[model samples]
Target: MALAETILRAVHKHDLVPKLTRALPWISLLFSFASVIWLLMLPIDGNYRKSYISENALMPGQVTSYFRESEWNIVRGYRNELKIFEGAAIDERNAVVEGWLKDIGLKTAYHRLHDPSVQDNMYAILHAARGDDTEAMVLSVPWTTSDGEYNLGGASLAVALARYFNRMSIWSKNIIIVFSEDGHKSLRSWVEAYHTSLDTTAGSIEAAIVLEYGGDSDYFEYYEMHYEGLNGQLPNLDLLNTANLVSYHENIHISIQQTEGEKLTRNDYLTRLKTFLKGIVSLTLAGIVTPSNGCESFSGWQIQAFTIKVKGTSGGNDITQIGRVVDETFRSVNNLLEKFHQSFFFYLMLGPRYFVSIGTYLPSAALIAASFALSSLSCMLNSGFTIPHFLLNISSVLKFFVMIELSSFLLSTFLPYLVKQTTDESDKISLVNLILLSMTSLVNINSKFAFSMISFSLFFIAMVIVALLILNFSLALCIGLLAMPLQFVQQLLNSIEAKIKVFLCLFVSNPFFVVYITGGLYLEAFGYQNGTLNLMTGLLTSWDDVQCWTWFIVMLGWFPAWLSIAISCGLGDFKNQAPVSYIKKNQ
Candidate 1:
């Protein structure tokens, strides 16, 4: 025991904690670069694998789909009936849909939006006779989608399916058919009311399938699964895989949002990479910048929902194939004993059949965010790792962060209302940009100890971005990647030749330029508009429509971080500043 104690003491004598602490800064710096490389690898072919069923119970397309010729005639009849109400008022259209639901022998309900962002909605619930009334599934069909396409065929298909589902006794869960105007708006309100009000209750919805078909049903270019929900939330991968598998069994070609689900070729790496990037963009902008299908209304409710867009202009596919996909997919879900828990909830898709799970992609952002923590630790360690003293040193910088956040709050809150008074919202945004520049200039006035302030700011922003990364990958990662250079940028600021590069970096990453120039570049890169006007317009629209946090994230999150970097750079040299330093005592 004495010999063991001596050996333990000997091991303790060769302490490596100091070396590790000394290595923290370099490790943190290296991690930022490593994250960039990691992110780049995600788009490569071998980085992601083909998606398969993760849940053994989810036997997709194993059952027969009976939504064929007989119910199809009912689909046509309802389609014709809806055509009659094309130009009618919203209330009148809803009344007609409700009456049809009652005639079909189902319990129907109606909901009117208080704000009138969209029109009212009509829904029917078919309670299962074979099982207890505890859980349900939803089939939503919009009169006109947010995409501005008339979903007549989709609506009719829903009504027919409702009628067909009501007749079947095999259902173990209630089936709900919803008809809402403007796809997302009314459906969102209805879902809120459904969970909140007794009148709208139809058990707890476990899953939903939104039908978004439009144009002639004689042909379609492709079928798309609109799965992205509000704030970048996605339904379980099993649900997506089930839908894809069911579609395959029906001989239906399912296309992902960015690319067609064709067999991967040796030369299709560009297409795959583009799909990966586009998927990231969509996830990043989910609630704020991206338009929603009705399925998005079910987000955050634990109700896995996705939209089926049977798209076409003039092609050689029938719309009946969509009904079959929905039929078998729902049948698979109905067989589930409980909610989805086996497969991934967060993922990036390369194609309908390919995906990169959270495990594969999380490290990229995690490393970037983690770097700031290490940097903060290194700074604290330099001051003897006293928490109280570290907090005291960073207190003023925290206040400065608060001040910048206050400025952001003002900009985000007032800008939306103020933009309404302007002929163009961009003018207001430009004015805000100038105000931010003026505020940044004020922050640039040399503080007593800017290094500590910058370090604390880095830590705080890292905390914020880490939180945001959970909510929206695109927004958080973009801020993190941009913030990564600040550590290196501060060192280079003392050199005259580096100032030009510094200014260039700051100029391009400027909040306004990010919104205009970088935004335009992003849009153009993804085959969107080649100009900045649309980007600005999208921001305004998102603010007005859904109160999306693009503006808040820019002002509170990205802009403040940029200001800290700028002020640190502008401060020039840290050598002359007298900060309380750590001195290792003689042992």
Candidate 2:
């Protein structure tokens, strides 16, 4: 008791950390700069490690593959057969595919989802000849991509593989071949149904591979392997590593999202930087907004999945090599003693061969979040470190936060449905931009409320980013970078130029605007048609079908927190410091 009294008296008599408190802003700036520099360092050779196989039981590319010229005619035959049903009804196409599966002497099944989409699922089971049916693998081929491109090459290859698997007897787990109507949506529904609703299941699924080439006989340049799963989830690194090594073994080039320059070249600084940025963007938006690649449907089921698509036309490699890659890859996974384990589940790939581990890249996001936390604490200290800040006008502050949040909530609830009412591609984004722009209100603020809300909101952002860092590092870092200036916005409101700077920050940081700009850049990066409506469509479907909370957080949490801070800072009266000084003295 005597010791505690002495410390309290010392604290009350003298302010020991005033200098430290004043240095918080500079410290935060330095930390932010250092964090950004750390991320930029990833493109350097030493900052990343070459990816390797983690599971020794599964040795990739060790076995000789017999999937060469023998199966070429069969694949072409199926590809030719699919041309008749190019624009046919869903049932018609499914019937044709199911007929081919039945002809291959396999147990075929018909699954029709009772939805208005009128889409159906066609699958066949190739029971393992040498082992009991205790575990299984999936070879899923979506009839058409979510963007509405029919996957003729992929389906033909899948059918050819089904026929080839029936001829071999080295299989351990049963192989289930699936052809879904919709690339992602119907595949997800069918996978869910296969586990929970269907009476016929091959047993627990161990792994899945999705084929997504659009042309059957054409020579391709490189393989684009997509590993991101729903909700920003990633497959075990071993699975990706297996496929990557096997592709190299077959003399095939490979790449991932947004990293398409000179394929298989990671030596140049610009190549590495572009690869890092593109990969980060793709992984950051995984699940909720990023374009679906059909492999994500198998996530959350303890099943490792990836989509392999052959792109470009300049290369000499043909479907035969792709077949061998798939065949050897399957043989590798088939040797797994148990499910995938002992490999990284969270990692960033510089390319197929190189990767930056969670340890190397995670610190960048952690530092940014720490800066926010530090700024929040500094604001609290300025207000005399009150718990709930009783000096704040509780009634007014409550109304302010509630009002701003309610507006965001209302938009989140209805905007998706509202966009569906219009079919115009331009109008879809226009609606969002208009609604958010209208939601903007430039009004005066209470200094006490500004400080308190900034204190709370900054802390909230830091916590949110910390949580997101575990789930999606790119998202956490993106939000942190966007809101970096927010902590000090309140202090710089004294001048007109400062106010304009704040407005510019708010303008660029708007999530809707960010989506529009980034969405365009992503489309333009690849030769994809410019349409953000797909992103909106994906967000809506993910929210309704998969119950993704990313949309909700963006709506009710992210936007509201940002808008409240912007409103508080935009018109806040900082010239009069009397209120804060009075509260400090009295407290």
Candidate 3:
């Protein structure tokens, strides 16, 4: 009893809250700097590991590919057939593709989907002769990319592979070949329909490969792989490794994020830094750009899928060789008696071979987020220790938080309806609504820096961090780094300098300004024009099609938290009163 009392007295006498408040700014800065350094070091040798196949059942490239030279003739025949449907209507094109699929002796069907747009997706299934309808694999190609270019060679090659697989008797899993119109939208509709009770015939999907041949080039110099999924989810790493293994054996070069074969020099600091920065940028933007492919649609349904895009003009592998690679991959997947469960699901690929796992990169985000939690705790502790009043203040804060969140929710839900009723220009609605909402937030700004409000903001941020880390570590970390300065800015609001506080709070906490400044810096660093607009468009497209959560996180989670702090700081009337002095005065 005496020892416990002594400990309590020591805690009370030292007053840990003041010490933490004084040290928090330094701590946050140190952590942020360290995180950047840690990310920069990830691409160095000994910091990352070479990827390997974890599933023992996946004996990749073990099959002797019988996809011979004759397949090129078949590819040409299908390409010629596709020429007839070049300018045909949607129904006519569907019929042609269906007829070809039926001619290959596969059960074919069409799914009509309407969302932000309308599309028709055609699919076929090759039943396994050796097994019942228990599991299946998907081989899909988009009818056209987002850029509105037809994937003629991709669809042709898929047709040829379907015909070839129909004759093979060694298959144990069924093959579902899909030709989706309008890329991501069509694939998303088909996957959703297949999994739901709407399509009872669709079996459990094991894995999927999406082929995207950009042009009718005689050959591709390399294959560029895309594996990011909706909301920053990734397909199992084993899938990527399996593809890599197959391509390696086929003597085809594989690229990631459009990066060609570049050898890494361990001792060259500049080379390593460049490589590391590229990896970081790719990871940060994965949700926006890389996941805008056909394969990402299946990720939400828990089916492992990725896109293999054929790139280059000459002096590389031909369509026949690429077909062989896919064939071998399917054969390896066919060897699987169970679902993929042996590889890392959470990892960042720096190159074709090197990768950093979750354990290595998660700390960067956690430390940044911790800074906010510490700041909130400091505020609560410095509020003075009148137990009943402190409890009462916390209770009041919770009620206020609930009210504010409910109001924001109602506004967000109804604002779209109001805009739709008022304007026919769908493109302008978002921007106008954003402006109106910003004006709404500026109204009735709270002029008091209450402990409850700060605590609530901190709580919201912590929840966002935890949820976002599970979805996308890069996004969560980026938001945390951006929002860290808000804590210090809030502290400054309690001073007498109203004009400076308003400037810092509005400029620093504004999402639009942050995005603009960051975008400008990005363009300057990379020497790319219109990079910001392209990035913003990609992010919006991903949200509309693939359901990427980056934009939503910014608009809903981070934006609202920052707005609350900004409003309080802008209108609050705390003149030359320190936090400790205010608490004592209240007591």
Candidate 4:
């Protein structure tokens, strides 16, 4: 026993922990950089394979679609009718849709949702002939797209599909056709109502398909499938694969991430990297921003849903053909014995046909997140080993930590309400100025160890990263990568030059600033003229409507950490001297 103890002591005394602590910052930087590079390389030809339907029940493109030239007249007829309600009031338009649904000999109902905005939605259930009303599928179409353009083609096709499917006797699962007034808000209200039993007539939704059609093109040349859902939730890979397969069999070109008609070259590394980064950015934005489509609302309910947007000009399938795609997809869902379990739920889609599954892509995110953990551990160890009074002062540091975090939480919770209540622009400006003045004057005017608060803040940020990773991996990865520099740069803030660099880094990395910059870039890329203010306002509205935590996490969790770090940098120098000296100097 004494020999064993001696060996253990020798091992412990070999300076291994100190060596690791010394090397951790460099190690974390290398790991973070390498992981991102590795992620960017995943879109290469050999790295990812063509996605296949993992669910055997989803025999995509096997059933021949009978939707032919005969349905084209019906689609055209519906489109003609939609023109009358083009600029009508919401109630008038919804009544027209409800009348059309009733004409199909189906029981229809209208739901009035007021999420600080009044909107009306219509729905009808085509109860299955062969089974109980235990399982159901959703066929949802928004009255307007996110761009506020009328989804004329989509709504017309949906009406036609409802009429066509009403005559079919082969369905074993109920089909609920929904016409939402607005894309995200109305669908979320409906879904929430259904789950909470507010809509007693609604059944359990198994899967959902959102149809979004644009342009006045007679023939649909291609489709864009948006699979990312709320909080980084993804629909089953089989669902996406099935849609791609059906599109291919129907002789329709399929695309994703709005990169329609852009062919990827397998041999070019830069092109592939661009494609990969585009996917990452899309996923990250989807998680951080509001729900882009109605399908995202279903994610909160654990229902697998995605949007299939039809795009084209002249030489492809028409509305009838698009309806057939929906027809075939629902038929496959009707064959499922249970919820989607055979395919990956977490994946990064490279294109309509290719994807990198969680197993292949998650390590990149995990490694980046791990870098923060390593840095935190190293910081704790270095402080404890180098500062003799670290233990004695830690209690006071923790008290300050708690106070800061609490203040941050309170600020985040009340600031939006205050901003919203301030109707006058001048009042809002004055309120902001007063708050800034009060905070600056009262909070840290004579405080010592103010710079040291950054270390504790980093620790808090590390915890937030871990929690966020579990909730939304893409979001966590994005934030984690942005905040990674703090881990390495915090120690170097002792010099003015280093402080300036750190301050700049923190400023650029602030979630609010990041959101503004990214929002501007996204608008520019997509050719939208909307400014950053509108985008930020829309994001905040989404948070209020859907209770999305993306905004809260940034404001309450990340922003406070950033503010502390910035304040620390501005206070002059980080006191990395012995904790005894730090405490004595402050006293």
TM-score of model 3 relative to the true fold? 0.85
Instruction: Write the residue-wise lDDT of candidate 2 on 1-587 in tens digits.
Output: 99999997887677645545656767777878888999999879788998889899889988998888888988889899997788898778778888888888989886768887648788889999876888998988887764456788888888898889899999998999988865566788888888888877788898899888775556888878888776667899998898888889888888766456565655676677777877777765656553467787787788899988777766778887888888888899889879887879888877788888898999999999998888777666654334455345556766777887788788787766765565555576677778756655445566666777776677778888889987878778887887787767544553445777877767776777766776677655555455465565556567656555667767765677777777767656565643232234443
Runs off by more than 4 Å, candidate 1: 1-29, 43-47, 261-268, 314-316, 373-393, 417-444, 469-471, 485-488, 524-554, 567-587
Full ranking by TM-score: 4, 2, 3, 1
Clashing pairs in 4: none
Per lDDT, the best of the predicted structures is 2
Q: Return the TM-score for each candidate structure.
A: 0.83, 0.88, 0.85, 0.89
**Candidate 3 lDDT by residue in tens digits, 1-587:** 99999997886688754465556656656766776777777776788888999888989877789897888999888888886776776567768878988998999887766554556777888999986888899998887754356777888888899999999998899999887775565677688788773463547899999888866765878887877676667889998898888888888887665565454213244544565456455556654542256666887767888888887768657889889978988888889998888889898876666678899888777766776776665545543333354466666556655655665566454543443354565656677678757965665533333545665686578678877875788678777777766766545655565568656756775776766666667644544456666566555555555566666677678877776665555555555335563334342
What count of clashes does model 2 give?
A: 0
Model 1, 1-587: lDDT tens digits are: 99999886875576445556656769888888898889778877688879898888878877888888766678888888888877788778778877888888899877756774577678888888876888999998887864576787887778778777778788888898888776555677778788876475668888999888885464576777778777668899999999988877776666676455353222366776777776776666555443366666787789899888776665655666777888888788888888999888888888878888888988888888898777766665553334464566566777776786787678667766765565777776788789867866665434334556666767876887789776777677877876665555433443456787777767766767776765577756754544476566556555555445676777777777777667766753554433333423221
TM accuracy, model 1: 0.83
CA lDDT scores, all candidates in order? 0.72, 0.76, 0.71, 0.72
Model 1: weakest 10-residue lDDT segment is 578-587
lDDT of 4 at 278: 75
lDDT of 4: 0.72
Summed over model 4, clashes come to 0
**Weakest ten-residue segment in model 3 by summed lDDT:** 261-270
lDDT of 1: 0.72
